[model samples]
Target: MTDLDDPGLLDDVHPRAVLAELFARQVRADPRAVAVQHAGKELTRGELDDWSDTIAADLQAVGVRPGHLVGLAVERGPVAIVAVLGLIKAGAGYLALDPDLPRRRQRALISAAAPVALIVQDHLDRLPTHHLPTVWADEAGLGDAARPEAPPPDDDGSRVFHVVSTSGTTGSPRAVRIGYGAVLNRLRWMWTDHPFPTGAAVLIHKSYGLVASPWEMLGGLLQGIRSVSLRRDELLDPVLLTDAVLDRRVTHLYLTPQLITGLLDELDGRTSAAPDIALVTSGADTLPVDLVHRFRRRLPGATLLNLYGATETASNTAAFDTARLAEDAVTVPVGRPVAGAELSVRDRHLRPVPIGVRGEVCVAGPPLALGYLGDAPDSAERFVRMPDGSVLHRTGDVGRWSADRQLEIIGRLDNQVKVRGYRVVLEDVEAAIAEAPNVTAAGVHAAPPAGDTVLIACVAGTKDLEIAALRAYLRERLPDYMVPSRVHRVAALPANSAGKLDRTRLADLAADAERPVAARTLTPRGPLQSALATCWEELLGRGPAEAEEDFLDAGGHSVLVVRLIGRLEKATGVDLPLREVLENPTFGGIATALQRRAAR
Candidate 1:
């Protein structure tokens, strides 16, 4: 066996070398550059350093310390940035929670993370059930919570900050421990290969915008570069995003494919403030060539790069730079591995496959993960492996090296499906669905059919495309069994924080649509509350859901509303909108609304 600790190999590059030291070096070298921007406001590097120091001091006040995980659950703004820097300055990892996630989902994440404290925006107050100490992300008092005068460290004390969270899949999120090694190496790679001009203003607009913007910021922050943080919610208006970028003199705009698509749709003739950003990067999901072409045509000044990577894999594993997107290689190639990263195809045995052979792509590099939280070092072998001398990471992604050594991602092994005597790749099926005219994103889910598997496809289509035509088009690419039994043509697919189609929530939506379940009027139960309980029983079906449960969260929607209101009107003899039923959904709220209508 080859020496597992071979010194010559790239895998030997220490993961610890990736983080803290670089951040400290950067800070010391330059402390006066603007570090963050929120809603057009700028915070300089020195200000950010001082601010982060204060925030870190505040975190210590709240009992958070080095090596602890701080839950960063807040909207994308100055507060989120400060909280992140604070946690990292304290030498802790942060679990990012977006404000847009459904409360139940956020609660599940909090449970999984089990953070020492959750730093949140003030508007979000319903998170107590998860029952963790809450640190407000933007506490004005934290400004004075500075670190005390200290003697110099014996060593060059510096730390690379890492943002950690669970995979977008596997339901509830948890803390995925990230050492600076992975984070810094990835940034260093970006700087070496995709260098941007110093002092360029970069606008970060992606969902995990903080994490995604690392490439631009890590490079920019040290060189007096400006980073702009536009609120994702505010940018729901595409014009606002464009305006924000142009107004802020944004020179590098990193956004997800969805946001780019939204901006394209909203923009007709285009006004001023078309961001002067010279380089725009987007990824985390497939960037359709059509969209890529559209972006290229629209943004003539920028170099559009399709970046593909995951949270654990140091944010970006590969990138496909597009000079002209439709140049035969329209599909984004995760590009050549950055410096300190190694890429090779491997078989199931973890042996390296021959060049150009398709197998699971294994990455052996300096930037490998430190492993998940609470997981054993042995557990690292599951993804970070020592199978063939050098430690290699087995990315579930199926890919092969080209003649040029550029990787071509086939799909994920987890996405592979074996139908009745036939193997099917869901990515292949998704590609077929996207073949339908006007379909941008396609999600396919399977349910068990009698003696066979059933396929259901949810596609995002424009109004111009008919479902029948889409169905007909899909029939050409997919076989009969593979053809979807139900094809939903919605405005767009529901994407989670990462801008990739959320398969779990899509599965839930599919189940909800299929089952057609309705909500029942549930009241707080007590012997003394008999009259309210009786009203609930008579007005709707079953027991009361908790106060936190919304009509929609309880799996009730408009179709279910039709049945519910029919039943409610018959029992309570009061008509209410499907909206009213959902708004004041509880038995008490519904009853009170009915009583008001009666009095009127």
Candidate 2:
């Protein structure tokens, strides 16, 4: 038999055959155990099982069937978990839809998935403008129907379990289809190797739509560990989240590098021991050596693990536990493959490169997702066969195998990028920006000259666009990180001899054009304006400021606004509210607000 048919190539996941089956087993073993806690609501395993059973029956009544896809527009809470589990029991795959998304984008995603029905919470204040039939969380008479049982595992493991959307190069949603076997293999591996002490609570920090969400939500459930779902507001404030972790006695936590940095900053060199934390997982960007050292020094009792994976791989394939890592290491290695994963560094022709030589990182084994949702070109290009008849995925990331068999990722081979742990396609950002009103063309680039990498957009529009307005427009359509940090308006973008956009020239322009607009001629007239201008200049990275120059247009964001307000309050001894500062973002306007507050 070929490798595809060879039973030895794949492991048989028994007892806990699939996710729904495993969850059912957990419920049977400890029905009274707390399975999830979110926003003061504690759900026992028995409660969750019964709740999900009712929801599953309701879903089945609404025509949800095996292998069918359903839309989930609920936020992070107990209901979200109930919906996911209930859908699994109904033998349906779910596509998580972000409720905060704009109506247009939501409609587009619904059209793309064509889910049989949308699952939403009854308490949600807003609903997407779509024609799909919806199943409300608070539907009546669901308990009258019998609970559905978990379906048997598909022998070939080709059953789609769920779908997560990643940014596409074509400016549309790229839905990743993960199969039951692929998810089961990863979950089983985590349950076997990454064991948490009994009663440990995994923190669900990311949104339900991100790939990390599954690992946080389902990974804990697989091993009978309780999960704590953070509130949406708590996620935006690191200080609040840190306090929640301490208050909730959270043992397991997951974060991106950016959030880790923010949390570290909040801690501010407090090396006091926090022994309650057993493990801390981080990914989305390369974890710096200094940060790892800092984490070990402070939280010595916990293990800090660096995970490396993609959405197509069903989550992480490799992990490096920094607690045992050497301090003098130059570059933090991505570590060896995790359970059931195989890694190889190969050249363009797919030939294995020698150890210590940098090449494309390829992953083989059960952790691989079935493929992209539909027959997209990238689907075939990513999953290809080897001469040995083994299916390996081309990760497009460059890496090398060390002498000790560790893998160190160097960089990507394409323009696709990771901004603060979120994958983004530069072309996608440009496409979205170009489609904005009054914009003719746009070029976007990730410029990281001195480690402070930020996305810069160079646009050629028919009419001059307000920086704040443009940013607000883009934020509604794209994720925050995909929105350009700086927007440089130009008459026209430069083109090469082939009449195609010359990205190299655009990069040079962005590098040189750090100051987007000329300084306004109106200089600070009084002491208050001068002091406010100085604060603005220092925070915005500008040479000098003008009274008429808008603070937002000068690259000042909400965070910077907070900092500026704090400094002004301390320096001027005036109590100023954030709304006052934001209402008047110009130098003169802020000065006036400060003067009025001082007079009061």
Candidate 3:
């Protein structure tokens, strides 16, 4: 076994560094620089330091100590950033919770984290059922007596920095404990390789509770770069995102491939290129070749990078520059390992596979997370010690090493599914659905045959169970994507002799149970409506559509909406606003609107 302290190998920098310590260094160096901006609120480094210190003091008073996990429930804003930094300053790890997530899910995640205290932006009256002490963001008279301190007294890198919840093997969410040192290492890597200019403004539009949020919000603090938080609604609008980037002169921006595609489509009809951006990093899913090319064309001045990694590994293990892709390259390579990281493709036997052979993708690095918080068995199984004593994290993704040594991700080795860029385990959705009233057993899967990835859920329940009610139940407890496009009442879900779920049979049953569209009672009144209805029918793969049937309920999602709108624009030579398309989604409403537009 290779010795860890071998003199020949260079020692890692920031070895004993804590995440808060790194950010504190920047605050001391430039106190007057803007540290964060959100809505109309801006906080300078000195101000942010003071604010975080006060919150930390409040946390300290509430028994929040070193290594404690604090649940943070707040909207995406300057206050949210303050809460996160304050948790770090208090030497406590934070579990970020999206205020908008279903109360049940929030409660479940919070219960799993078992935080000593829960912090929120304003009122905590609406918070889910939890027994933890609640700390309000506006703790006015509590800690204002003392002057703002710098960082905390503690500088232990071994303490857990944050607990990130990801799709678990079971139905519940698995919390991953990441050390302060691991988070610091990732920031150090970004600063060294993809250096952002000191004090440059960076747009942080990613949602809370996601792994990427920390990288965007805190990573910038290490280099004195301003972290600008965009509200959830602002992040959803393409035009707003473009404007935000340009208005802030954002030097660094991160997006998923889906967002990138939406932004590209928004920019397509524009007369000029978007304002110059320094770096645009994309991840969370495979970057499509077409989207890469479009991004290059739309933002020629920006360096577009495809980052590949997982929640267990903090951030990126490998990065691919779209500019390096060969003209004939069919798949965009994930590129070589990042600094202080190693990539190995190993077969089922755990032996290294040939360079060109497909196998499980494994990563080893200093930035590797501590492990799954409460899942020791899973942690041991996924993180294995090699014969040489080095640890390797088996990322269940299947990929192969290219001729040029780049990693190409091909597929998943398990039941994990990604919908519109969010990673989800199928069992998690099934578990959520099974909790519904009267649902005896539930099976959920992402069906690709619907022309798009539409979630189809089948449940064995009483004959009187309503599909719409079941959908509403899921919607209240899960994200929209996790909700089924259609809920089919199955007599009983088939299982194999070994007692495992027979997914093949479940899928077949789901396919056979889909509802066919009924014949239209009302004929098209005009060519505009007639043509649009025909297009909708073809896109929905249904017969004549009902006038009031919800478009999304009819198996359409945001992705399909884009394609449908694009087709409508091409067919009718009329530029339509996305708001109109969404608002008048039904055939009768859309048809009438189109006819009116033609009249104009």
Model 1 RMSD to the real structure?
A: 14.9
**Which of the predicted structures, 1 or 2, would earn the higher TM-score when compared with the native?**
2
Q: Write the residue-wise lDDT of candidate 3 on 1-600 in tens digits.
A: 121123332134323234555566777888888888888677788777777778877788788887788988876767777788788767788886777667777777887778899888666456787687877776363335343334444455457777777776565667787777777667667766777754467888766677767778777865677887887545766666766776777778888786777667777767575665788888887777877887877788789999888888877889898999876778888888884778899999888999899999998977687788775557887999888988889999999998889899999899887776778888888988887888889887677752346678889987668776787677688766666776778889989899978988888887877753344555666667666767776776663446776667666665566566667777887656667878877776776667667777
Question: What global local distance difference test value does model 3 have?
Answer: 0.74
Across residues 268-304, which tens digit of lDDT does each residue of candidate 1 receive? 4465436576887776455667777777777777788
lDDT of 2 by residue, 25-85 (tens): 7888898898888878787888887878888877888888778889888877777778888
Where does model 1 exceed 4 Å of error?
Answer: 1-34, 102-112, 129-134, 142-145, 148-163, 167-175, 207-219, 265-268, 271-274, 324-326, 375-381, 387-389, 416-600
- lDDT for position 40 in model 2: 84
Best by TM-score: 2
Q: Output the number of the lDDT-best candidate.
A: 2
Over 4 Å off, model 2: 1-17, 123-128, 138-146, 149-156, 268-275, 387-389, 449-452, 464-469, 516-600
lDDT of 3 at 521: 51
**Best first by TM-score, ranked:** 2, 3, 1
Q: Any residue pairs clashing in model 3, and if so which?
A: none
TM-score of each: 0.63, 0.86, 0.85
